[model samples]
Target: MSFEQFLFYFFSVVLVGAAVAMITVRNPVHAALFLVLAFFTSAAHWIMLEAEFLGILLVLVYVGAVMVLFLFVVMMLDINVARVREGFVRLLPVGLVVAVGMMVVMAMVVGARVFQVESPGRADGDYSNTKAIGELLYTEYVYPFEIAAVILLVAIIAAITLTLRRRPDSLYMDPAEQIKVQRKDRVRLIKMEAEKK
Candidate 1:
């Protein structure tokens, strides 16, 4: 097999293995770590497909930022392993059925001949996928792209609004006020007799 073919299979296996490990692992932290592995493997596959920008973005955004945050959250959360595992036996049959149904649907859709189009006649370094994607995004898909961005922004705002709490007893300072504060609030001067030896 060619080097590309070998890399394809290698990355595919790693991706699948990591995904399975992510689902099967009992520890949430381990599952998150496996998910990071899965993301890295998928990024490698993207790189193999010559999607340099997307591959790097996937690694930087998902693996670097998102997965690191997930890892920290998983580590900090007090999860009850036994309580989580308690429903596994009851849910296994339904889960298996859903999993198999999804697998069958995926096989049917993905194995179809519609996606088997002829490869574009271009040399390895002839064309830029990023440029093509950017052109399409800026031209034909600009409305949808902006809509997605707005939706994501709204979701972020909603999440923050839902989670933010105002503690009555906690002291809080406004940044503008703090920035404009005089040294009088920050420093206290007290006149006292000098300490005698």
Candidate 2:
């Protein structure tokens, strides 16, 4: 077979394997690492398809930032996987129904030939995908984009706040509590009598 076909099959196999391993792995960290491998393979496939910008963005954004963030959160949270899995069997039917429904919907949309398999849009001379995306984002989708950014900002702040819930004995200062501090009460001098040696 051709090099392109070989590469495609190789990446596709790795991607599928990583994805399956990601879901099936008992260790959360290992699952997350598997997910990263899946993401890398997906980016490779995108690059193979000549969508250079998307491939690079997928690597930079999802692999570099999001997946790392996910892994850190998974590791840091100390989630009890066994406890979490306790209800999986009970929820199996619901999960299966949702999965099947989604597959059906996807099949309908894809099988109906809605997404025409045309030559990649940038097949011609020097068609700038980044420029086109920038123009679209700035001109047509600017408001929605800004709103989404604000929503994501709020989500990040909320995640930080939730994870930072501290005991009264904890040292981390909350700005809201700090604002109530009084200058007169700030520091008290403790008098220590001199001990005769």
Measured by lDDT, the strongest candidate is: 1
**Model 2 clash pairs?**
none
Model 1 spans > 4 angstroms off:
111-114, 124-126, 174-197
lDDT tens digits, residues 1-197, model 1?
99999999999999999998888788898899999999899999888877888999999999999999998888888999999888888898998999999999999998999778776555867688888789989999999999999999999999999988999998988999879999998999999999999
TM-score of each model, in listed order: 0.81, 0.71
Estimate the TM-score for candidate 1. Answer: 0.81
lDDT per prediction? 0.90, 0.87
* Runs of candidate 2 exceeding 4 Å displacement: 111-114, 117-125, 160-167, 172-197
- Encode model 2's per-residue lDDT on 71-132: one tens digit a residue: 88887897988887787688879978997898899889988765876765766788876776
lDDT of 1 at 98: 95
Deviation in Å, model 2, residue 127 alpha carbon: 2.5
Model 2 scores a TM of 0.71
Cα RMSD for predicted model 2: 4.5
Clashes of each: 0, 0
